[model samples]
Target chain A: MSNGVDNNRRHFLTVATSVVGGIGVAAMAAPFLASLRPSARARLAGAPVEVDVSKMDEGERITLSWRGRPIHVVRRGEDAIERLGEIRDRLRDPDSDSSDQPEYAKNEYRSLKPEYLVMVAVCTHLGCSPSFHPDPADPAMGSDWPGGYFCACHGSRFDLAGRVYRGVPAPTNMDIPPHRFVDDNTLIVGEDAEVA
Target chain B: MQNKSNQGGGTVGDWINDRLPYRQFVEDQLTGYYAPKNFNFWYFFGSLALLVLVIQIVTGIFLTMSYKPSADGAFASVEYIMRDVEWGWLIRYMHSTGASMFFLVVYLHMFRGLMYGSYKKPRELLWIFGMLIYVVLMAEAFFGYLLPWGQMSYWGAQVIISLFSVLPGIGEPLAIWIRGDYLISDVTLNRFFALHVVALPLVLIGLIFFHLVALRQTGSNNPDGIEIKENKGPDGKPVDGIPFHPYYTVKDIVGVGVFLALFFAIVFFAPTFLDLFLKPANFIPADPLQTPEYVPPVWYFTPFYAILAAIPDQVGGVIAMGLAILVLFAMPWIDRHPVKSIRYRSFLYKALLMSFAFGFIVLGYLGLKPATTLYNELALRFTEFYFMFFIISWVYSEPRSRNYYYGAFAIVVALIAVIDLVRDMAGISWIALLVMIAVTAFFLLLPAHTRLNESKPVPERLTS
Candidate 1:
């Protein structure tokens, strides 16, 4: 090669070096980024939780913790279940279409069993747990209130079936976890019915 | 000059000066820096903001020594710091109070910019740097908020993080990545602690340095908005300028003393500021299974939160809230008027600015209350007014666009009335609609009958 500068060779080397350096930097970043994902301990902590609902009376609800989220198990009375059908037309997703749930729980109840409503209590809008207002005419909820969930965070309302009402901030129905009934009163959340 | 000569002649000083541009930097940034001599009461906030930043950092370092960062231990550790650690309550109160005061001064500083047109032309980059500092400060405040591990902290974080998940496709994954788990748990707290104490503070300080450097480059904008550099003296210094060291340094020291008195009064007496700074719900430890009866973000964030609540749709609300903050960054380009200060701007512009400020306060007030139908309606009206101020500024920046401004204002009022009718047909709703229409007509018709569009002639020199 001549003593003069070889522009083409230098350009190629510069581009090649930059490309290699960029790739090397990206490769080094992979582990650090991956480290931010849910660790093994966190994953193990999210293991299926079993909740007993035998002693729960009609219109009573108990909150359970599963995967660091509030899981609500409400023992619905006959009247509450009937009111669910009455308010179907007013719900944004009454049929549970476009909402989250297992195939077995995608029906009208949004649960494996119609009587026991086991679903994630978190609001789909901003994740505040919706308070259960099971009374069909709660008076505080208003005249047209048909027993369901009402989130005070942004006034998002849900039907007795945990179906979101129209014109609320929450876009979808309350999420139904991968839940199934182990026996008459035992409910297992975070695991599909098929797993049993 | 005497002190400089005495210090410079010293052997050690000479050795250091040779190695580093120490004296030159101080002179260039402080003693030699020529700033506007016409600064008013509004000018004190910038220096006060720096003071608050220093307070936050120093107190933060001390608190971290005794505070834990885990989900389990964080709440208890904070209590321990309050009860067990000597003088920790005072330090914690200062830090907490300092956070609010930081926002308070920064807001006033920003308002000063709006009044004086500090974000125009040569100082656009400076304004951008300042905006970046504001954004980082917000993130810093947010991350620190979760360190208390209280009910409000947990649920508030939940609401904010979930805002990211409103986007299609990547939203859920992005939120999951941010939390480092399915929910706001131990991992999330750990990472947030790292970010709050280490990452964001570093970014804030770096952004502040750049903000100052950019400010010095273009010099400071004043109330008169005149370029002092245009009229230089025989010595090549601006005639309307004064050395920042002796003039502003002494002035700011007095401002600092007064500010510290007020700051300490709050720290010692009403540190919680009647549950505005340290929210009552935050006193309780975080329970993942239960959300508080109401979950409103702190006062500083409420105005934007109100904007979010005003919109009925989740995605739309989230986008609107994000735009509310992001729109501030565009202020440098949004108002295209030639006038640098509100003093010379038209009556319409002043009214719009006042309305915008008033609407922001209304939104903040509405945000604190429950999202009832009435509050939501009010919030929606003010939210429209809030966003419209920017549009009106751009539209009515020139005298020729007078008709366009009226047309836009009328359309907005009509839309609000229609929305009110559609949402509620009650007597009160109709009355609200009537009042809105009357107010709009008054403002619009009043301008038509008067010379509201006429702008005063700008002065050549800065005036005290």
Candidate 2:
């Protein structure tokens, strides 16, 4: 049993390394991603980056970095929009499980708008950054793997609502950090206490 | 701890401590670094790559001094160097063409690594770091190319930068932000110039140092495909090995010196001598409304460039290109063949290399294009084959040396290709493509499923 614990630690470290590496690709990319450095002072001044979502078509995700972390704000597909209306027995948290948000965010979809699902893209389990495993039935993930955050760490699964799957290593759903839209294209995080 | 042991007027303990603790250990192992006798011209490519890296750094440092990061001065500065600066033309070509030569050495180096099991355990870091070097070199080139802010440079960057648009959410904003505005503009150019000229070079140097360190630790895996570590001769030295210090270094200098002469020639006489050098039309400030006619990357980048451009989907193309390079790292573990050398690999593996080579050349040709239907289709087809060959050749090539006859034929076919490339470039109108196709055919015709008769001697005949 002690030997098993050691092996588990080794496995944990291995998984952590891959997660770090995968995210490292994105993190290292931040500095060089844009031709211009996001002026340190201006960014530190805490102004939200204004995006033009006017051209963004539905069902597409546009990634934005908030303070160096990837904020994947995906527009819901028609089916996903409908799926949110019909919460099933699969979600471990029957009604948006963790109340880690303010009163305004305690909703089925857990967002300011029904069409857009905004959540901190990092996985709740082991902090291994989760990939938005949007397609529920992707063979690479599995049949039961719902359309959600499939953390490569310990194979944890979360639903599209960011609710953790039962029996998953992830003890809770992904954090939906407080964010409110200043305009249709502009989102301000760490502000608007209701959204925060 | 090691430096303190000096003998002069010092105690025995102090004297012993002055030398590297490994002095005797390294000695016992003959420094454990030696090159095999059979390592031929192909073996020199890695060191040649190192040579170009040095050339690039030296020339790049000088270029950086005069190079302005802003778009307004970037193009003019390049022109200034070409027209005014003494030997500025040489510096520019040396940098530009050095990019191509760097790829040549790396591809050959990678091929050398593949042929030998250089990615095997204990030395895996070497190959991994080498792969990092390759990645840095590419990023370095891409960043530097933007410094000139040429038409193709701008638009090519535009198309590549836009690949991020496929990300599910935030893609548009990220893409926009990445451009620093709506498109690849002056802001993008200046920052890219800094990263290209300064940031990426630092990363490349660091990666190269690690790569060489790892390589020295394991020593070179020679043509014989034997691990010198497994057997030590009576003299406690690698039997078929030669010291890298004076012996191979002197020999490698000939390769390096000749390469340098060619380097000087490209730098001075024909800075963009080969239209492959891509003249300054690429340097004109980028106009978003007008895309350059036939926008293609530098020739060396063409194959993977072709593969990326050929993908029908934006995100798919980017992922495919990234995976293509990443896939090389797994070559050691994935190549299940018991035999290390291609000379001994069954008919399938030999065929795979040639096909991969052919696919690479075709993909390269396609990458430098506007992606017409025909070219796009061909590029896509070759892309599949490019990936499939890596997967197949890596998995299938166990040496059943009774098939040595097949191996010889395949090698001869590859040789014919080299000859064809030479003769055509020599203005002989030789059908290089057809020969390369025939090389691919050599792999396609492999009798992998056929059971060989054991009575076959499979003797020393396979070794050149």
- Against the native chain B, what TM-score does each candidate's chain B reach? 0.93, 0.80
Among all candidates shown, the one with the greatest DockQ: 1
Candidate lDDT (C-alpha), each: 0.87, 0.65
Candidate 1 lDDT over B48-96, as tens digits, reads 9999998999999999999999988999999999999999999999999
In model 1, the clashing pairs are none
State the TM-score for model 1. Answer: 0.94
- Deviation from native of the Cα of residue A14 in model 1, angstroms: 2.8
Could you tally the backbone clashes for each prediction?
A: 0, 23
C-alpha TM-scores of all predictions: 0.94, 0.61
Minimum summed lDDT over a 10-residue window in model 2 chain B is located at B453-462
Q: Model 1 over residues A22-136: C-alpha lDDT tens digits?
A: 9999999999999998888877787899988999999998888888789899999888777777777778888888999889888888878889898899999999998888987
Query: What C-alpha lDDT does candidate 2 achieve relative to the native structure?
Result: 0.65
Docking class of 2: incorrect
Give the poorly placed runs of model 2, Cα more than 4 Å off: A1-196, B1-32, B394-464
